[model samples]
Target: MTITTTLEPVTGPFVWRGDELSRTDDWIFRLGPDQVAELEEVGRRFIADDPDLRTVSAAQYPLTAAAEAIRRFGADMDSGRGFVLIRGLRMEEYDDTLAAAIFYLIGLHLGEPIRQNELGDLIDHIVGVSDKAYEEGGLPSRTRDKLPYHSDSSDAVALMCLRPPASGGLSSLVSGATVFNELLARRPDLAPLLLEPWHYDWRRQDPDAPADTYTSPIVSWTQGCFSMYAGADMIESAHRYPGVPPLTGPQREALALIEEITYSDGVALDMDFQPGDIQWLLNYAALHSRTEFVNGADFAHTRHLLRLWLRRDVGRPLVENFGKHVVVDRSSTRTEDAVRDTQGHFRIREAAAVRTDWGD
Candidate 1:
């Protein structure tokens, strides 16, 4: 039975920001000597094993802090704020190898690592790798550009800061729930557009990869919970494909409102990064962005970050047929024929709860 539905608004711990979350330090977990030592040891072991980046499994790199922090972090992602910052990583003490091992282990505790793309890379480098031409459809992470509020394509997205640029890389986060609530109050007319399956360009999602375009809802409601797959940059690029319908004027306005609220006042919680810090954001309930940054001349001084896009073996059920890693349904995947001429016949992955490394 085919059914078309709108996202039904729901409540959760994620529907908060500003005053509702005033203390920045509350979300921070500063590492003490014991935890730092634990990480350093893990890093040493990771390099000693000489495992390829792709082969580094969390099981081999364990953590003393894992049992408690990872447990709480999982719950927080599932039911709390949908985001957290792990502070006090001693990046200055270890080389890149050890530092990444720390990040990898923590991610493993949270969920299984998914390849960011067909290249099968487990870690993505988030730096201004190159200048993007106007036609390149630059991604904010790959360039020194500002990002509009958008959710990542994974169930959970994480970034570990290795270095910071000279200035202007502040991160901004807004609650998808708050954005939804404000829409209902201010622009109820345009809110439903999010529920409809929209075209999302993959592969060429950035300069690093090339692929095809697929369709999924920007906002999906399933099991009485709201899940979002929003990326203003990607959404805008989807229009370039002839297969996707051009966004309506009202849709543009709705996007504008989310961006407006994201920067407008106290709606988004902004934070700066310190070396060794990990920022984890739940792609489902939180929208995130960063300001443009400038790098200094020294290569060592340039900003370097390691990124991970995690998928739990089990997690929230999605209304749209979202797959394990890519945002599109694996089954209802759009083919070249479907994308160009045939519109709605794409297959969506059969709906089911994802079972993460952590038991459901």
Candidate 2:
């Protein structure tokens, strides 16, 4: 397997500066009244049917009026800006069931929803369940820590805001291409190190995983296409396990430099999430993170979001084993048989409900 360490800097629409996007609303797609009404109608009927979440198809809830807009959204994430903020769902009018149903319906149109954990939840509830620190193995989504910029193991990831935090928790994104180009310009000597495989902690995933660690390069360039898979936490934590190679001095420097660049001025775009907003990002093109947040005292005021890891069928070319962390066969763990409550709603995992070392 040959790797292109001296690849030229990537250039495309996916390369963007956060400060530049801040001045425009092009990334935002506001749903129209008709689209919202259509979603509500379909969402209610789907909830009434209460079909298995995994078995439900997009055709069942045909978002006829919003189909074109939805297609454009896919285009934006794929070829335009690598992310989209969908605004305009009226949260007050719907309960948790309706909201989840609606988000699931839209997700179906986007791609196949994959299992997010060992329990096989197609839609994972992201809420802070504890105040534990990440160093203590606390789940990032279950704690109020400042998440670092990183990409998930999926073609695309979606988050629909069900409830916003009382303060902070601002979601931020940085273009991986932009970051790569900057690294090339500033320190070409270190750029090749990114194409070298680095150990990632697979123990943070399912206990039944084949290996305790997996290796993959940070950047992969294939057939003139660029893709990136990054998680500083995962790479750094892998060293704790036996048999994993230690990080060299240059590797440490490269990692530190990447993080420093991600947090540098104008690199990351931050958004204060609002209830009823859905943000979709192409994992290969951009890295996302969150600010430390404060949740309210009551459950009603708790910060909550619905997450989806989508296996998009779009033919985006990628190098072999680029995202080895993503689970491929979920047939045994699929959420088709998830239990439901008397209210005909799937039980959502509470905050801090995840394993401290769980990786997603």
**For residues 83-182, what per-residue lDDT tens digits would candidate 2 score against the true structure?**
9999999999887778887888888899887766555557766778775676777666677778888887678999989988888889999999888888
Off by over 4 Å in 1: 1-9, 52-56, 133-136, 207-210, 323-360
Estimate, for each residue in 108-146, the C-alpha lDDT of model 1 and write its tens digit.
778766655443445666776557732455555567777
Error of 2 at 286 (Å): 0.4
Q: What is candidate 2's CA lDDT for residue 40?
A: 89
The candidate that achieves the highest lDDT relative to the unseen native structure: 2
- Estimate the Cα RMSD of every predicted model relative to the unseen true structure: 9.1, 4.5
Residue 255 in candidate 1, Cα distance off native in Å = 2.3
TM-score of 2: 0.90
lDDT of 1 at 36: 74
